[model samples]
Target chain A: MPDYLAGIDIGSTMTKVVIMDNGIISSVMGPTGPEQRRLANKVMEEALRRVNLSFKEITYLVATGYGRINVPFADKQITEITCHAKGAAHFFAEARTIIDIGGQDSKAIKIQDGRPIDFVMNDKCAAGTGRYLEVTADALGIPIEKMGPTALGAKNPAQISNICTVFAEQEVVARLAEGVPLDDLVAGILESLASRISRMVNRLKVEKELVITGGGAKNVGLVTALSEKLGCTARVPPEPLLTGAVGAALLGKDMVGKALKQGLPLEKKERSLREISLY
Target chain B: MAEEQKKEERKKRKTATEAASKIGGMVKAAIGGTVRAKEEGKKLAYSFIVCSYDEIIRAMDIVPVWTENYAGICGAKRDAQRFLERAESLGFSRSLCTYALCGLGFDQWREELGEMPPDAPWGGQARPDMMLSSGQILCDPRNKWYQAAQQFMPDVPIYDVGLPWPMYEDDIEVSEIQDYYIAYIVAELRGLVKFLEEQTGRNMDYDRLSDLVDLGEKTWNLIWETYELRRSVPTPMGTGDAMNTMVPMVFMLGTQEGYDFFAELNRELKEKIAKGEGVVPDEKYRLLWGGGLPSWFALTDFNYFNSKGAVFPVETTYRMIEPTYRLNIPDTDDPIERLAWRWLGYWTYWFDKAKKRPGSEPDVERLIQYIEDYQIDGVVMHEAFSCRTWHLGLIWQLNQLKKIYKPIPVLVLGAGDKKSLEHRELPSLILESDIVDISSYSEVDTRARIDAFIETLESTKKSKADQQ
Candidate 1:
């Protein structure tokens, strides 16, 4: 039987699963909900169904991201930081730096020879993450997806000086009250967020080719602003949101391969793809 | 729901080491002793730790109420919230040093109530006859904390002693300024002695002070030796226990108890090393707690690292004792002069070596030396939100250290292979929180960061092994 491996990433705002059999078989992404365990199971079940397989067919599994421990059936858990580095490296072999701005946190990881050498994360704040843009977008009555495109169309981007997300939202409203263009407001928001993330990324001595991953990377305007700030054009994977999950799956395969090479028993759960019963 | 369940399933943290466990009783007695000092006719004085005046106070038979240690006890016991709230209400910003705020808040409450605050940790910090405000070069709060406390108790006098050292300069030898700095410190000590004599209505005892100073030097040397044992692989003790052991070294410095405790601790670590015992059963990665004061309330964070197969063999916090014999001080019978010399020596101990090291300052040099000596795989630090004195330089130090290369001997292969050396950069992690502010802490976030750091360490280890 061909060996199968799976990776699940339960981020603060999104849940993703990627299934692999030597190469990628299927991948799924969805918004995370309060019921993390159910969401994890449901996401995994969907990804498995897409590949016509059940949990038992997986040779090994790994979970990553903020809510990784919530996936009760995962064979092992790794951090999203490591998963992102590996996944970015997989997509871009020469990738040396990764800037991942997720739902609630942003991090810059420095890579050497496809391995994470160092990283720095923003302090406990939401000013430099996807949450910042989401809050600003809601305040401006613009969809999070539209903010990026709207930002790219700006004739004159307003200078946003507020470092706090709440204050930045207030600033956006104040600018709108003064009849500032919506595109300019959106551009200003992305610029401020990019600057914050760039400052953190610079701490690692950022080198090219920098790959921007995570849901935040899906924002073209923010990615461009960050690349300009970093003085290096950044690359975004085909599916930025799926990189962490893909990396986790690849690491799971590596673990299984190592276990077999050493003739060591692999630790895994007698599994199910169904949601765990509360009772 | 499953995350909460996993958190619940986590094993209870292990207890402190044997020597460390004894700190609780010692601390209780020391605090209780201050409360009873008036009844026993011993004058009680408020003092800060590491101010280098413990011997003088002891010789004068003045009982010291260690305000910072009391604040730390309040933090450890989770009883600091009430005091913190009181201070915040009194116009103290929450962003100020929490230790100072906690101490100030306790003093304000006590002065108002004319008694101890409700449920004060360890019978409350006793009211002092006088306050010694440390006007040190670092810790601006130290110079202000006692003076601010004096607002409530106007009758009590305050003594501000400046404990400045020759600030680090690569070109200037410490010997050039040692005489001037020592003279200034000696004058400060003499002024403190005069102030104490006036308060107690007794003349200064030079002979007794000399003996106490000698004892303090002995205790300092003993502490340096005791902590040196932690350099052993799979260290028998770690920073977690050192936090406990630091109480005696910092607070009880001129006393026999302090020296004896370290003597016992030294013996304990030696025995553990003999049997090849370590802090954890399987020590995977040895880490250095590179900088910053720890979150006193959440010391279990250390245990959390231990559970992940990481052990902190050494930390650049609280372990303040350095070898005193390294400095050349003109032999002086005057205890005050010797005390001043010792103080200057301790601050400048790493200057010469730091100057020789490329891209290194004193703090960074100490970190590099400890990493090499302890065989550290990575560096971990806590950045207390309020204490910028220690937290500010950490980022720059790590950045500078990364820029400098440390040659690691590697064995090459396939071309008449021989062992060659390669320069490599060390990995580091910075945890953010406050020394006593539990509100700023998040166990989930901290653990996630730790997990990520461990992964990075694992990857680096694998890369190194592959290269070899």
Candidate 2:
């Protein structure tokens, strides 16, 4: 039987889990509010039930993301920077730069020689990340998932000038009052969000073969705007949000192999990454 | 009498001219030596020194230093750019503080060269042997840079004096801080003295120590005077230049040389004021700066106000809280408490003693007292990223200040590292506004957003006066 590995990412807004069997991602799932560690186990259990797998089947478990330290069952924790780089490299192979925009923060990671050599993170505020989009969506009374397509319909997008999400919402409302077209306002919001992410990437010199991931990667409008701003195309994975968890699981597998080769006991218990869910 | 007055004016002008000339000459000489040393295939160590006050590092015997002084230097500017590039190449993320990258770049440059020149400020090497820091600023880059320095120079010692974060004035926290402050001072002083003794094969004499302490006291007095002058109408110093004034004093602290310089400055500033020559000509509103130093990229916003006759009287938590630590004297048996008291007074590491009461917090009270004593008109709060401690009670403090002192306009600017400034509209709006309606507070997001708010304030004041 092939050994299975698990990866879990506990984000501020969402929690993601990816299970890999023999180096192939078998399944992935995400739930909101996995931020609390105690609650993560329950969510992970539900995810496992959906995939018809038990925690005992997994040989190794690795945790990544902001809440990595909070995950009690993980064998080891790797920085999101390293995990994102490894995951991006796995998918794109030639990707030298990885831009991950999660719910609360955004990060720009530069990869060299298949390793994350440098990374910059913006966790201090909710300006440029998915939070900004959420706020704008709430102001427009539009579902966030529909923003990308709606924004694409914009012809003459109005500009968003605020960096703070709270402030940007007010600005969006004010613009709406000024009778700006809904599509134009949406386009402006996307452009502004892209500009913020680009600044982080630009600091790293925005090297070629960029890979964009995280929940924000689902926004096609953001991808297009960021690509145009960066003057380079960014490759988006099929399930970008699961990349961190997938990378963590892969790392866990590597760790298990190294430990077994050194004649050491697996020591850590097998815990299901799917036990954690947002809802 | 007229001739005597004219002669005195000439002498003052000459002194001012001489001071400017001396600074220029030092720059020229340092650049010349740097160029010559570079050509000689000599390597130099690039050291980054981060502290709220410059005195401790200035007192150290190291030489060939590049500080904020090189920001405008001819080739120095290019050197900083190249240094930044090399730092990015070294896998340091650009999202980090520019100052850290600059320091790393300088270090890389020295590595590219072979050995340092004999007269290189850092003992004939371009690489720093030590990184001296204080916890006053609470900038993550300072801590991270020190760690990076440790990685590069595994053998070099990195010494840091913890400046209290959450500096709330209270008996318990203050007493505990006094202990930490005194212990840190004595420990750092003893370590440095011992190092110097080993290096020079002579112990630091009591006379020299006393003299150094006395000089520090004198510099402190001058700094107080400078702050006082900033309060005067048509304030005697512009905020742009005021920020730089602390640089020389900090870098030169704990030395007779620094003492002499400050003494000269004190004399010059006194005479200038006596003659009614204001530091900031046509000063209007006098604002207080709360939190870390304004970003270098935003120094223009500060200058713009100075040019428009607005004065930033007392800036930086260090200038406000450091003098309180003087009570932590060397002669006392309870030096540790004294040190702790000093540490407790620090802006970053201050622990609030009165957490139960929202408005009646003792730390908040003490801060209010400091602001009141300074007689500030308004407060400019920079809510910087990664500096969570500073931002926690800022809104509360603003509210308290308004309740006590009749609604002074509080402008809060949200700022982050270099990349954070890309969203500049929010800060610009705040700066331009007179009364920041909390509802409108988040509109301007960029670092430059404060400028807009300041402009709005000026316009509103003008309009109000026009109505009057």
Candidate 3:
């Protein structure tokens, strides 16, 4: 009989779902494919199954991120920018600035006491997004997940001058042909990406205590270089990618509380999660 | 029956754009005016939008065709891709301004085929007798778009006139260099006149040119006053409509039709205000589009905003007749000197004010003024990726505004039992897209940003009311 809330963030690269019920929070993450409805259902099913809950028991559902509109059962849709700020605020009570580098876009959200006051995003170019790092890592023959720790051991990092991901990959190949150390090249790529992010973050008049969320925050090398360039120690979420889903859950919980106060339930449809196949 | 039909029509939605578009249609229909002039044994000159050379061109009895205008027509019609690909095929990078790319491509294709491309937009831009180019600071494409294009029409001559202005800065006294700048511009104008006179085989008419300059100055005042009327509560017109109406302001300035068009527009706006009509019914939020040229392909987004109860009372982009009346003209009888001074006036209007006010930028100052006058709830800007002239200073301007201005007064908690006060900054949103490249734009992302901004504005509004 507990009131539950569901927050689903269907991003360009990943689909994440967070379920909150009886003061317990759990999440499931998976790759997003062309079939957004299937991805949304699969993640939601996994998250709910972990919590031993039914879709009917969820009081409110909020969707966010670029592919948010594809979530058919979402009661309300909010932007990832606002959700990221709320999600960061959940961890750091005084977190004023959020640097969220996602699959294709990065956002710098300014939070004032848990509410997003302003946000700046780099959606026009792929230079500073996770895509930049992904392509560069492919050229370096390094696993995307292991790029951080491997990059940390560089004695002298090669300087990457190109911000364009394609040109940066070309530079990586050229460096490899020149017999440049892989660790140094990776370190240079991370450093260059971090400096690019630092410039975008500074535009929002970044204030401390800053929190870095999204998949890119997992890279320890990037986190370290960002700290050095931004002049602040950055805080990373335990599951950086789930921050958006977590934020959506928080907003969804708030919507549930409001709907309960007004004695008006939100609009949502009951559907069989089993019907959706990842294929 | 007639009255009932009229009432039904009144209830139906109609755009104020028709009035401005009428003038634009006439102008576009005159596109092949250069070709017609050739048939009539008349001379034609190709020029850029910012040249302001129409007065001299008209005085010299030369037909003037704007390359930028032609480029814009192709953009609005969504016919630019063909010309863009042609330019790219000719080794011109797509990173260049689409306006320039489209023109260069069309010129090359026309010269190759010896005629207009199959079903070109606006019957294709007319080939020119001579090209008139300008060197304005900020737009590198304006300086280079024609030079690269001239390779196709090797016989046609180009008169490149330098009309550069000092880039905006904080410490430099613009007046210290104003005299030299004006003198240089005057000399350049004279040099242009010499070129035109040589091409047309006619003597320069100073009296007629002076009359044209006087007319342009009058139109400048009228356009400024006409847009100023939008500051009224429930503004009568929106910036999307202004984008259409500004054709005369861009092309027909220094002419009687342009002055009349604005005069009639001002009167219409005053009547709409008297009747208490707004750009949209239920105008919930008044937004100020502060800077950057709009994405031509996605102009319908204005209607989208309108559907969301957002009314754009003013935009700082195309309607840039901010402060023309306040310029200090030098003591000279020469119309070209006055033209030089007027050009400086438009650019330095806010700089002079910023000089008087500590910690102010021309662009940011204009933003603040428009925000207050228009009763704006939020500021939004489009950052076109290709052009740095309009896009580069945007982030700096936003940061400067946040640094200096605290417009929102909200209640706050103090150390003691008594409540203290705090001031918050207005929210600024920057939406990034290319001016002509449809590929760069994502409607879902843009709308999400807009929705988030509206939510932020809603919160800011609720808190502002809470203080009472």
Question: Judged by DockQ, which candidate is best?
Answer: 1
* Candidate 1 clashing pairs, residues 3+ apart or interchain: none
- Candidate 1 docks with a DockQ of 0.66
Stretches > 4 Å off in candidate 2? A1-279, B1-79, B115-125, B133-137, B150-173, B195-202, B279-281, B297-300, B317-377, B381-451, B459-468
* Clash total of candidate 3: 0
- Best model per TM-score: 1
lDDT of each residue in B1-468, candidate 3, tens digit only:
556634533342235444554654666667766557767988878887657566888778888788888887776666677888999999989888888888898999999999889888767877889888887878888778778887999889989888866776778888787888888888889999999888978999999999998888888888888898899888888887887777878777777878888888888888888999887878888888888888876777787788778888899887745445588876677888888888777777788767766777787788888877888888888888777788878888887777644544656566786675655558778988877767778986788788888877776676667665
Poorly placed runs, candidate 3 (over 4 Å): A136-143, A158-162, A167-185, A258-279, B1-17, B20-24, B32-35, B164-183, B204-207, B322-324, B328-334, B406-424
Q: Higher DockQ: candidate 1 or 3?
A: 1
> How does each model score on lDDT?
0.86, 0.59, 0.81
In every candidate, how many clashes are there?
0, 70, 0
Tens digits of lDDT, candidate 1, A13-67? 9999999887789998988866754657888888989989977888888989888
In model 3, residue pairs whose N, Cα or C atoms come closer than 3 Å (at least 3 residues apart or on different chains), thus clashing, are none
Give candidate 2's fnat, 2 decimals. 0.00
Give the better candidate number (1 or 2) by lDDT: 1
| TM-score of model 2 vs. true structure | 0.49
Superposed model 1: Cα runs more than 4 Å off: A274-279, B1-16, B39-41, B405-419
DockQ of candidate 2 compared with the true complex: 0.01
- Structural RMSD, model 3: 5.9
Task: List each candidate's DockQ score.
Answer: 0.66, 0.01, 0.44
